[model samples]
Target: MNFLDGILFALFAEADKSAPLMVPDSVQKANFAETVRKLANLDVDQLLQNLLSESVWILIKVLIALAIYFVGRWIVRRIIHLLDAVCERRRVDVSLRSFLRNTVRVVFTLLLVLIVVSTLGVNVTSLIAVFSAATLAIGMALSGTAQNFAGGVMILLMKPYRIGDYISAQGQSGTVREIKLFSTVITTVDNQTIYIPNNSIATAIIDNYSTADVRRVDWTVGISYGDDVDTARRTILGMLAADPRVLREPAEPVVWVSALADSSVNLTVRVWTKNTDFWDVFFEYNERFYKELPAAGINFPFPQMDVHVKNE
Candidate 1:
């Protein structure tokens, strides 16, 4: 179908026509044995010289190809090193730099291999055609992986989230550990590792907690209806002000009665803190509320039932 295939077919057809098959009789067999013995008895020096004269150029070419391969491989490594240095100098993101360096190395190695094959008298064009066909078939078979790869490239270029950033995407939340070609590696708070396909992450909503310098922490606490609402609110505000981790410039901590529940009054407390101190502030506040609320005579109300019994 293709030019190389047609050429091979024509060569095979000609060879088939020119070549003859012989069914030898006893006399012909005896003469063939005698001829083989005479040829074997020929001078060794003359045979060696003839063989060398015919194959010397081919042997030289093979050696040259081998030399080129070794030298080209060394050069490729040096080029890769130079590329790494350039990326380092430019202060590129580590993940993007690594991906680019690997891609460049693979491309250069492929080119070097093609050069070597061409030097060995192989048809480079035919090899390229075969490779292209195979690649196309593989691409069709792994369309999902191809999409992930494309998404990974986009992510590396766009940088929606960087490594070490805590992000929630694709129904999972974790710190981004690595951004690979087809997937991203994440480590969760519970020390679990997850591999999320890049395509899913790229398409889904990404919640990056570390993108902002500060984050808001909300808490809702219930107090008995009989307790002093002003006292509870003042206690929480004083606690937030005392904590150095809570931010106060942009907006101060807010405490207000949010809702009147069936058994108690729900007081909402909102505070701002550094992103890194959000969890610490949250847990510490909860612990302190449990301890200090009781000391402040603030009763955490519980459900109760009142019943009256007559003549039963």
Candidate 2:
């Protein structure tokens, strides 16, 4: 053989002596079986110890979360009590105080829940996202109720009417009893209870009669055309002067000839009185005018027409 042949023969011999690169199927199976055996023979005591440690850690977290919740609840109650005392000291309105208290409680409770959940290793961001989505869905579902809630906030803030105030709104007239989160409760003159939605009342015109210390009472008295107007006026003026509830500071009672109708003359009587005495004075004086005017030689004229008949 030549030198090149000798070199090639040496290379082939070296290649023949080298081990195969790929492992056999039998060797792979043996290795897998050996690995599974090693795993199965692992120390059971150590595994149990690891599991117990994990459980203890979880228990500690749970206990901590409970502690936080209880502490937060106590703090929230203390805060609410302080707020109530402050409100009382300031003499805040009942409706506003109630609203503020409820709002503060709810806000603090939600914050406490979030904090407790975070202490439990819960993802607070994900929970808040979930809460936000749920709130949006609920808001859309109860849009009218949401509007009423907002209206209630506005009503409490603006103070258009308060408890025990006689108010007229949305074709309902009553004395306000309670201002709630979504509605206003009122009692009518006839002793009927009504719940008016705050959204409706907030947007409607509200006539509060109890706001002013005094109110004006007006009456229209009609007498026959030929009856003595001066006598009727004098009689009404005397009755008004005798009433102790009538106010004289702003303006004294006055009678004016308002209009002359076909059969009778109309006299306008205006008087001022305390708000509490308005209705009583108005009704009592009406009966007095009906009886006293006639006793004073004044006549109440009814609509009458003369009929003429011609016989042919």
Candidate 3:
């Protein structure tokens, strides 16, 4: 009994000497216990059960987002339509409408994508930064195509020429068959297809012959120096008169000595005719002049080297 009492005394002494371990009083202890119970984490099964309890909320949020998107799409379409109507009222070019519509659609779709990403808790700024960097690379890589695109825009805006117009542009002479956003497609008289870069065509001089109803036809006929100029001129004039396709009353066809060459005099015969008939008149008139000049005592000149052999 004495040993037991001594041990008990030592335990009490040690407990007394140590700092007091604070514990909540009865009321605070009950409150803390209750709070812990309230704040206790749910098990996975419980969490899943809670989520599945009412999917209506999630669906509602998604539906709202989708509704907003659909409404926005409708609004965008309406806006595009309005833009076209306004353009039509204002007499805007057809090409302008296509460019504007495409731009609007792209911009609006980008906006929609941003909204959707933001809804999904994704950072849009980072995406935009990445896209911007990627776009810079793409733009640099397609610099030549971009130049052609800009050239196409300039071509459309400046109204230098249009489809179905006969033109000589960018070292190409043909009828403009298609004026696309990147290049102009042309069909030559010989049925050759020519694709001219829009930028090159935009920067170059464009000769639109179809703008005029009549085109001047020039015929050059060379005669031996000894041939009578007056008689040759009259004969050429008579040949032109025989062709009914030639235009008259352009103050009489001009027949003048154009040049004095090494062995012949070149006569310039210029007349006007319908643009469509220009080629036909050119070839026919040339053929007639060739046949008639010899009959009219006019000698056509040729390259001749007089060789004098020295007697050795």
Candidate 4:
């Protein structure tokens, strides 16, 4: 046999020369209690041989377990790399690729651990039972975390928004920077970072501004009531037409008298432009309307009170 086995055999041969160990009559009759009692009566030579034999078997088992673990790790890495290549060929989203890779790694690693434990002679069935019970208890205690995790999966699948998309949800609006397993990170217009739980975002009303190629910009321009409505409309339309960023095919820019308030007549102007140019067109046109309308002899309205004194 091997070196360790040969050594053990030699030791056992020497131990056999000692006075033959007494066998209890109950043990001969296959009584478990008598077998246990006979174990206490084992001579020093017999006990030493038994301990060495068991220890050698355990060491061999440990070596085999270590070999499996190391080989399994190498195989796991190759599998994950192949998975990444497949995902890339399928054109998966960057966030989704990360999630899938991590999930596969965890599942494979857990299976490897189980295999190693089984090699060590652990009872797989009892271990699974204990694991299941512990998992149930933890799930009950961390319900919110579990919900968030589920929500993350939903977000990745449903794709309500993606990284770099500007979205407004749960009373927070920002450009998404990352979509993690539990939360989404966004950077606000003012450059503030916000972490929103995926659960809340999934259930909230999401306004994804980046979904559409073009968006409508609306502004209300108020002029003095006496100002000519036709002139004001023409002036606003001219300004819209002058801006190259404004879209003209699907929708044409239009202005209408929306409200005749106490001080002014409000003209609502609506125009379509590329999403990227929405804010630029709105802010620039606001200043343009202020300067161009007044220059066109249309005065802005101001609050005024009429007073008449009656002398008795």
Per-residue alpha-carbon lDDT of candidate 1 for residues 116-165, written as tens digits (9 for 90 to 100): 99998899999999999999999999999999989999899888998889
* 10 residues in a row with least lDDT, candidate 3: 10-19
Global CA lDDT computed for model 4: 0.87
Give the top-scoring candidate (TM-score): 1
Of 1 and 4, the candidate ranking higher by TM-score: 1
The TM-score-based order of candidates, best leading, equals 1, 2, 4, 3
Clashing pairs in 3: none
If candidate 2 were superposed on the true structure by all CA atoms, what would the RMSD be?
A: 13.1
Where model 4 places Cα greater than 4 Å from the true spot, the runs are 1-78, 112-125, 303-312
Candidate 2 lDDT, 1-312, residue by residue in tens: 543454346434423336678878997687667666765776778757766887898899999999999999999999999999999999999889877877889999999999999998899999999999999999999999999999999998899988899999999999998887889999999999999999999999999999999999999998998888889889889988998988896999999999998778999999999999999999998998998888899999999787899999
Higher-TM-score candidate among 2 and 4?
A: 2
TM-scores for all predictions: 0.76, 0.71, 0.62, 0.70
lDDT (Cα) of model 2? 0.89
- Per-model CA lDDT versus the true structure: 0.87, 0.89, 0.79, 0.87
TM-score of 1: 0.76
**Residue lDDT tens for model 3, 80-186:** 89988998999876656666766677788889878866665568899999999998999999898899889988887887876678899877899887767678889
Give the candidate number with the greatest lDDT.
Answer: 2
Model 4: colliding residue pairs: none
